[model samples]
Target: MNAPALRLALADDQALVRSGIRALLAGFPQLEVILEAGDGDELLAALAGTSVDVVLSDIRMPGLDGFGLVRALRARGDATPVVLLTTFDEDDLPLRAAEAGAQGFLLKDASPEDLYEAITRVAAGDTLLAPVPTDPVRARYAYRDTSAPTDTFSERQVAILRLLAGGYSNKEIARAVHLSEGTVKNYVSEILDKLGTRDRTRAVLKAITLRII
Candidate 1:
């Protein structure tokens, strides 16, 4: 069977890195290079009128940054999946991206095979991938000392979190649960707070570790 066709965008501050990724991804007959962006703002601008299937971006860009771009996309209710390439695994970038509604995360030094596979999975709506760390990304909730949660989340929040862990978007979850987007957002906020995580994705991961999800 033919590989599924994908209209993809790329964002990286380094022209060299962008070129390298473009070259690697070129081997995938199903993936077309729709556009290249040097920064997050540029990426958003490119997305304004373009119909894209996926975005592979560097986490740290000159303007706006990858996290901000993902957040903006969520704010606009766009579901074009995003995949971030990061140099630091210990920076909380991946977890933050997920909280902001990204599709997946990959390390900058990942093998071409891994990169290709990640794109395929992201397009398929999966988020539970092995943490591909380049330099030990930081945990949103440091489990260094076996600390426990001080507050428990309600059943609704727990349900929201389980779906989040499964990589479903807030809008999707809202529609599934018959709740307004605002209410879902509030539940996410409370979940993060109760889980002692700075972002929802981190909270989800932490919840998994503690068997809370």
Candidate 2:
């Protein structure tokens, strides 16, 4: 039997951009656009009456932006994955998105294949961030103050942090590190604790800020 089409919700303040994205996504047969919202408020209202596999939202919008949307969903105990769309490549944006519980982040100009992959991966309970944005983010955010107080990280933890910065999911990180997934999860949890952050993205940012990785 064939798998069901994955349902998606889209939110953006710009009508033209929304239309463009909708048109782009229409090419995929295994994906279905179930909801379109003008902003986070509309997206939240629409979500009240519908179920979706993933949410694709612009990071900047009027009256509740992408970060707000994710924070709202998480506060409501809605675990629906969110993938942030943005035109800017600022490192802080992805860090904030991670703090808000977003599962994916991508540039607005991401290719159709990258968009599809991000949606599918997040729907499968994996996190993703386009590689194009990650390297620049790391380069720009790399710690420079060697005198700053920093938490000590083991070499293995640093390796995991590098993968996290690259947006690799726990399973992928496991493969790269040659460890079981569960063990990687433990390492991730410890990393979070050491960094005093709640999620992987924030952990990476903290690591960069402190030059721990």
Candidate 3:
């Protein structure tokens, strides 16, 4: 079947791995890689006006690293899709990626077809992580004690906060809750505001603490 075209970028620390990924992607004409980076810093440097539909990046890299770079990008309000291509979907990485607003977290050994599909799915605004409550990856996200008092988030903020905890993309939550994607984004912003949290996982932890979700 013909797949939708995707403008792509690859970031990894290893040269051979980058070349191999490029070679594999070359087999699929629908996937066009516009640029490549050896590390997170390079990825950041290469992003402006690169016109990428999706970014495939490693979980761990030198300098800015995967999670940090993804967090930075999302923080700057870049809606461009990002998928982590890693050797192992380390427990923390998935949750961290979710919290960082990454569109997808996928295993590196995933077939090229799966990789290609992930790029398409994320670019289309879908969550790539499997759905199952209490999954091991979710458990890996540590919930530490907070001595501070709980903040009172409104009902809408709490609702979006729970979906964020469940690793739902903004697009997914918008569909489920009968709101627009931009509105969901605003709800997430309110969640961050009322809970005094910086990112998704922190919001999750705060919700857990406050018994809001």
Per-residue lDDT over 36-96 for candidate 1, one digit per residue giving the tens place of the 0 to 100 score:
9899999898899997888888888887988888888888888888888887856445446
Measured with C-alpha atoms, the lDDT of residue 87 in candidate 3 is 81
Model 3, runs deviating above 4 Å: 1-4, 130-213
Candidate 1 wrong stretches, greater than 4 Å: 1-4, 128-213
Ranking the candidates on TM-score from highest down gives 2, 1, 3
TM-score: the better of candidates 2 and 3? 2
Higher-ranked by lDDT: 2 or 3: 2
- Writing each residue's lDDT as its tens digit, candidate 3 over 36-106 gives 99998788778965768998898888888888878778777777888887887445555566667776777
Which has the greatest lDDT? 2
